[model samples]
Target: MKDHLTVVKHPLVQHKLTMMRKHDTTTGEFRRLLREISQLLAYEVTGELPMTTRRITTPMEEMDAPVLAGRKLALVSILRAGNGLLDGMLELIPSARVGFVGLYRDEETLRPVQYYFKVPTELGERLVITVDPMLATGNSSVAAIDLLKEAGARNLRFLCLLAAPEGVARMKEAHPDVPIVTAALDERLNEKGYIVPGLGDAGDRMYGTK
Candidate 1:
């Protein structure tokens, strides 16, 4: 997508996201909605993927069929919450290579600390799409991208369920070349680094934590 940040405004995406944002929604419902929505979001995220023709034979005739070009795409989950989004995307792109980056914010420092990271080999030659549920402060997202780049991922894209303006600006400033795809761009974040009018802590809500 040409836009640095593409908000998926499809009716199904918006409707499901709104249900996910409701305070009264149960964990089971939220998880189901996330899975359903991620499939749709995956469609938007992969819109610009390159395609090529592959020779194939039909029952009646043989012809060249269009197929994705280049190496199999890579799906990098930002750990914990990202796994939720990852699962759904995997359902749609079952052949994609998978990886994970684990990060947690230090309470006092409020900065992301990487605890675990493992990415697919030859990342530079693959289209790497990193996923997370929320983009609030963007610290962890930015840090994750930094690690991915260090690991040799040149072409990368970010996908999230919700994004704050601050996070969008932060990503634009840090990785302008990497496009961001999201279901919603909510209001500003609160002092605690949570997206305002967001669905609360994504991990907590999805996993039924406090």
Candidate 2:
């Protein structure tokens, strides 16, 4: 992790994202597209995971195969919307340890308020990757990462579908040690703290809620 942000520019990601942004996209289609995109994003996010050699018998003969090194990775979701990303990533890394951090904004202060938090054991020994669909204000993402750090996670990364510039800058300022990986970085956040041109409230769109 470093002061870095990776915006995935894969053609598939861009195409699916465009479909999701359309107001007419149904809940079922949106959810399906999200799952597909998450798997792709997961591929990029885990591209650099450390590898080690393991001696194994192949169809031909015994050989050393490259396997993931160290403990199982931790996949922590940032509440409801994060679960959408989590579902697809799980299909890719079924053995990953999972966790969740729940937070809501305080209307007056517009700050994150924690309602629930739980994480896997040996977090310090595992590479922790937090998932959330959108990074608008960055308050919740920063707060979630803060808690992960407090829980002893040493290696950390953030994943999202879309992010506003304000949120990216805020994350850089708050947790420069944690790198962000997103599908797209949008122009800016509107006054209501929503990412402009972002697929509207991820949770709502995914679940067909108000």
What value does the lDDT take at residue 42 in candidate 2?
95
Query: Candidate 2 on 138-163: residue-level lDDT in tens?
Result: 99999999999999999999999999
Question: How accurate locally is residue 52 in candidate 1, as Cα lDDT from 0 to 100?
Answer: 99
Write the residue-wise lDDT of candidate 1 on 1-210 in tens digits.
788999999999999999999999999999999999999999999998999999999999999999999999999999899999999999999999999999998867779999999999999999999999999989999999999999999999999999999999999999999999999999998888889899998898889988
Candidate 1: which stretches are off by over 4 Å? none
Best by TM-score: 1
Candidate 1 yields a Cα-based lDDT of 0.95
The most accurate candidate by lDDT is 1
